[model samples]
Structure formats: C-alpha cells, structure tokens
Target: MSEQAPHPATGLSALLASTPFARAYTHTALAAVFAAFAVERIAGSVALATILGGLAVLGVGILVARRAEYSLVRLAPTTLLMFLAWTLTTVAWTGDRGRTLAGWVALAGIALIAVVVALVRDTLQIVRALGDVLRWLLSISLGIEILSGVLLDIPIPFLGIQGRIAELGPIQGIFGTRNMLGFATVIALITFLIEYRTLSVRTGVALFSVILGGVTAVLTDSPTVFVVAVAVALVTAALVVVRNAPPERRRVLQWVLGAIVVVAGVTGYALRSTLIGVIGAGTDLSLRTDLWSTLVPLVRFRPVYGWGWFGPWAPAEFPFNYVNAVLRESHASALNAYLDVLVQAGWVGLLLFLAFAGVALLRSWLDASQRRSVVYAWTPLILVALLVDSLFESFTLSGFGWFLLVLCAVRAGQSRSWRERMRSLDGPPGGVETLPAAGGVQGPDISRG
Candidate 1:
C-alpha cells in the first residue's frame, strides 16, 4: 500500500529540525551576549545587565530542553552547583546584601549557560562561537580606540582613552583598562590560532587577527599578556608533541614533564626575588605588595566564611578604609584572584572554587590529549591563561574569565573521554564483548592541526 501523506505539523517540525538556526545562530548569539558583558561592561546599568543576562540564561535553558536526552550527572554540574550554592549563602552575611544577591545571580546564570553550551555544542561549534565573538569584540575595540585617538581628539574617558591622541597607547579600547585589553588580545590570538589551524577561515584572516592582537598587546604595554602568551605557547606545544607521540614515548614524556614541573616550581619559588628583578618588577610589585600586606592580615578577621561575595566597601568599613588609605585610590578587588576569593568567600568559597578549577583543568587536559583534533586543545590552553592571569589580576569573579572557566569546565566534563568514566561506572553487559576501536572520533570535519 502507498504511504499516507505526512501531517502538516509533522512536516513543519521536520523543516524546523533541518534548519541551521541552532547550529549557526544560537551559539553565535549566546557568545555575543557573553561578550557584551565584557565589551560593554553593561554600562553598570543593573537593569540592562539583568535583561541581557536573562536572555542568555533563557537561551541556554531552551536549548537544553530541546535535546532529546541529556545527562546532568557530571563533574561540571556538581562543582558549579556547589560554588553557586556557596555564593548564594554568602548573601546572608554580606554587608551589602543586594549587590551580593546580584553577583550570585550573574554567576549562576553564566554557569548554567556554559553548561548548556557544553551539552549542546561539540568542540568545533564552541571554538567557532568563541572565535566569532572575539573577532568582532577585539576588532571593534581596536577600531574605536583608533578613532577616539585620531579623529575625535577627545579622550573617551568611558573607554579609558587618554594622553596624546597620536600615541598608540596605553589605549584601553572598549575594555576600560589596558590590562583588560591585553587580556582580550591574548584570548584573541589564541582563538585566531585555533581558527587558522582548523582551516575554519581563510589563512589571511586568522593571520591578521594574530598580528593585530600582537600589535595591540605591544601598544598597551600589558606585561601580563607577554607572560601569559609565552606560558600558553609552551604548554600548548608540549601538549601537542606529547599527544602525537607513540604510546611508549608518551609515558616517558609525561614523566619527564612532571619532573620538569617539579624542578621549575622549586626553582621559581627559591629564586622568586631574582626572577622578579629579571622581569623588572620591584619587590613591592609596583606597590601591589602594600595592598597585599594590608589585606592578608585582615583576612584573619573573617577567615572562615569571608566578608561576603562581591562585598561593596562602605567608606568607613575596616578593610575598605585600610585598602584605600594604602593604595590612595578606590579599589574593588585585591588585585589577585586567590586573595579576592579568600577575602570575599573566605576559606570555604576559596576551597570550593579551587576544587572546581582543579576538576575542570584536569578534565580539559585529559580531553585535549586524548582527542585527535587540536581544536580540543583550546579548552586547556584558555584555562591555563585564566589561571596564569588570575595570579596577577582578580578576574576570577569577573565576566569573561569566569565565563571562560564555566565554558571550559562544561566542555571538559562532557568530552568523549568522560564517556569512559561512565563506562567504568557501568561496565560491559554480560556476554557482550567490545571490539577494538579504529581511531578517535572525528570532530566536525575540520582540518587537524
């Protein structure tokens, strides 16, 4: 018998399913929203920020709900939930309860969004989304800075433009800080490298991004960029080489690497003063030591729970007064991610965050090494950059760095290597034998680096 014509609703559903909206539009839009938080700074308008954040959160929820079957039983979810829960609890003790609540909501929203992206998009889509967003953000920022300097001739204070208009920098671009611009440059360079390596875009475009990022970094005089760039390069190179090595050589290389790490840590710790001098840093770290010295002792006052997450310093408050007196400038952060966490969340929040970061990094590293495609490497590389940057800057709770962390954590937790963990938990069924695998699964038909 001939088949009956399909129902109208069924046909519409099929057409919708075939559409590329989810593949092309959704991920890109989500990335743009995330970038806006950093690029626009949401103009510190709580209402605008809330609307944008809500949109992102809603997008993630919708996407995840559309999936046929998905698992939330993963490391990323556990760690993030713990972190978010702790952050929310802090509102109870926070001096400024309202701000603390806002901070918690923002954190939770991004974390959930990251999890959704990880669950829905594969590695290639993730990279593409990141590349597209950064390409636009960095490019627009560079263009604006040039315009403000050359044509406007008026300092764009909001964007942090100042000094002689002819000078290349220290231009803050749309990021509002030279260091922030530097950080964006580093991320841009990495994203462009991935795009170039994957042949996802024309070679010239990727090369241009690299060159632009490099030039911006130089002009900005962001020392952190140089340090982070070198570190990421070395680590990436090591990972690539080791991943490509034969099984036997891989084992030896890992041991050698471990030994090197141990030696380097000891050496770095022992000669930290000398190294700082070599890097042209004073013992006081350009007056940062003074801030640290003041804050460290004060942490003892609320050593267990912290003063509270994202605590706004009331003028007469103990730590705020002390910090402002020493720095001679109003400061929001301790200028160190670890210290910020310790000060805000106390030991409990710090420990939870550390555990969260550790799990994410470990999972991402494993996935990168196991995967055949180099695009996977971006996850760990970005994580490494975040870790390195956090040592000098308090970006852990900020927008981009935190967003990247959540993204990486979710990606890592859901990587194919993680499937092995599931298999371990529920071993092969009786009388069902598995055949040897041919090779690692291909990633999105993209070129292998």
Candidate 2:
C-alpha cells in the first residue's frame, strides 16, 4: 500500500486549534470587560454579571490547559505556600474574620489564575491575554470618563455618591472621587508607555484613553498621585533616553541622571512645605512616621507567625483610626504598604512577601537579558513604580496592583521560555562541527561550531 500524505491544511488547522493563545485571549478580553464595568459604576448588577463572565472564561482556560501535552513549571505551589502562611497568620491574630475571608478568596483566585498560566505550553499566551485586557481597560475607562463628563449636567438620583459629583468637568469620569480615577489612569498610562513600540490601532485607542484618564487625574487635586505620576513620567523618559544612547555612553548617562533625580527629589522634599504648603508637607511626613511607629510595634507583637491572613488592619475599623479623624493628631505612619503588611501579617509574612517580589523581579531581569525582549525593558520600570507606590499606598491589597504583578510574572515566564528555546538550538557545550574551508578544503570548524 502507498503511504498516505496528510492534508495540506491539517497542520495549520491543528496548530490553530491546539494553540493555548486563543484561550488566553478570551480570558484577557473578559478581564478587560470586567475591569471596564467595575470602573464605570454601570451598575452593581452589571459588575456581578462581568465577574461571572470572567469566571466562565477562567474555567475555559483551565480546561484548555488541562488538555495540552506540554506544560510550564508551575509556580502555584509556591504561591499557595505563601497564601497558607498568610491565612494562618490572619486567622491566628486578625481581629476581623469577614475581611480575612475576603482576602483568602481573592488570594485563592489569583493563585488559580497563576496555575492556569503555568500549565500551558506557551506562557506568551498569558502575557498577550493580559496585554489585551489592559488595552481594553484603558479604552473603556476613557470612554466612560468622556461620556460622564459630557452628560455631567444631567444627574441620576439613584447613583448615590457617584451621581452627586458627576458634573465636575471632563476629568472626573463616572467615579465620584478624583483620586480613585487618577490612580486608575496612572496604571493605564504606564501600560501604554511600556507597550508603545508594539501597539496596534486598538492599543492606540487605549493610549488615547490614558491621556483622557490623565486629564481626569489632574482634575482630582490629589497631590500625592499627581506627584507620583509626574515622577514616573520623568523617570521613564530618562530611561528611554538612556536606552537609546550608545552602550558605553549609556552607562555614564545613567549615573549622572540618577544623581540628578535623587538630588531633585531630596531638595523638593526639604522645601516641600514652603513650595506646596504646610498641610501637604506635614501630611506626607506625618503619615510615614506614624506608619513606621505603628508597624514596628505590631510586627514585634507577632514576629514569627504574624496576624492571621489580612487580619490586623481592617480599613473599616483600624487601630490607626486617627487617620480618619478631623483633627489628624495621631501622625501615624502606617501609610507605607510594607508597614501595612507587617502590622497585619507580621515580619514573617513581610519576609515571604519580599521573597515573592524578589523572585518576580529577578526572573524579569534574567528573562529580559536572555531573550532581548522589550517587555523585559519595561518590566523594571513598572516594578520600580510598584515599589515606590507601595511606600505610600496599599498596593498588594488593591486589585489593580495584583493584576499588574500577574501580568509581569506572565511576561517573565514567556521571556524565560524563549531563552531556553534559543539555548537548545545553539547545541551542546564544547561541541565542534567539521566543515569545508573557504577554498572548498575540508577542515574541522574551531569556532565552537
């Protein structure tokens, strides 16, 4: 019997059908939709609807990954270990059971998603999915902001807190608080900046949304966010310039620019009261000092196991309640995210958290160096921003921050995979190949062939 040839389209069709990329894309799209609806204040019902939709997409992704023959190294077990530590700490020491349970659920969901990504043959699919989600989020967020601004004059009675200040001009969006909108806008802007080189038309729209979101952020009058955004932009621009410079010159320029930034930041802090006003100066310094004091004692109280997962500092009821007081006498410095974690989870928890972040950062750097991908270039900048924001914000506790971390991890994994593939193609160490010389004479190749 004659050997049978495969159909011409069989491979192509199989490749498309078996790829994990499509499943990842679907999840990314759904996540973007959910984020958009959440930001728009569309309706609590709508928010619930999207959450359910995301869960459905997640389920599909899980199923697809399960059927794949190849798999990436799973990071979920490590994540689960950290989560268990957090849960034990929270349960043992935390004052609020309800808040701890919520944290447990959120952490569990994040771990599940990480597992889904880890079980796939191509980790790039997860990175692409996250990129898609971010792009959609930026566009939808901008559109909602613009629409709310245009319809500001007409208010709906049932919208509650969001409706009262809906008429505040082009910057407020559907969100009543300017700071919240600004925070969200900054994330979108950073995402656009990072992905600018590879952006398509859809991404361009997302970038535009970032600009509109920035306009709203400016309108909010939240000096801290404004300062952070400006600082991030300046740093990012400087890094871009350095990256474009000749290799030798780039090193020199980095040192000079870094010194300038440090000096400028310090000088600004020293004169901040005179330049910005006493309230701003006092507010900034006081929060850090208070947080330090509060956290030091709390961490000492539970140095080993720490408070139960997400237990100690419930935002609804806090030991640092003076933060919400009109007099503002308590000058507590639990303003730092590290401090918040330390207080709630203890030193042990803090160490675990640091280990997780360190692994992510190290992986990002290693992958970028090995793969020469631009995503790696942007990873450090985003990581830096996350670290800086954590100094004054509850980054880990925020949905946006966790989402960003997950995106970074996915990109890092993709880069690492590419590096491994390249190494495999390069052949075994110290191996040599026999080849013909330029004049057609046979010779053994000596250049690590």
Instruction: Compare the candidates by TM-score and give the number of the best one.
Output: 1
| Model 2: residues with Cα > 4 Å off, grouped in runs | 1-72, 76-84, 87-89, 96-99, 114-176, 202-210, 241-300, 311-335, 365-373, 413-449
Q: Which stretches of candidate 1 lie over 4 Å from their true place?
A: 1-44, 163-165, 281-284, 311-318, 416-449
What TM-score would every model get versus the actual structure? 0.84, 0.65
**Index of the highest-lDDT prediction:** 1
- Model 1 agreement with the true structure over 294-360: per-residue lDDT tens digits: 8898799999998777633444555666788876977767778888888888999999989888888
Q: List the residue pairs that clash in candidate 1.
A: none
lDDT of 1: 0.69
lDDT at 376, model 2 = 43
What tens-digit string does per-residue lDDT give for candidate 2 at 1-449? 99998886665445443445446434653364335425445557456445644654554444443333323332332543674556655764666667677666655555444434433423223334555565555455445554444456353323222332244532434333344455656665665554444342255565665565565565555655666676677766775676567766865776788699789979987986676574354565665666566457656656766555652245454544534353355432355667766766667677876776666665664443333234445555555566666766665443545545554554454434343354455432111123221121223422111
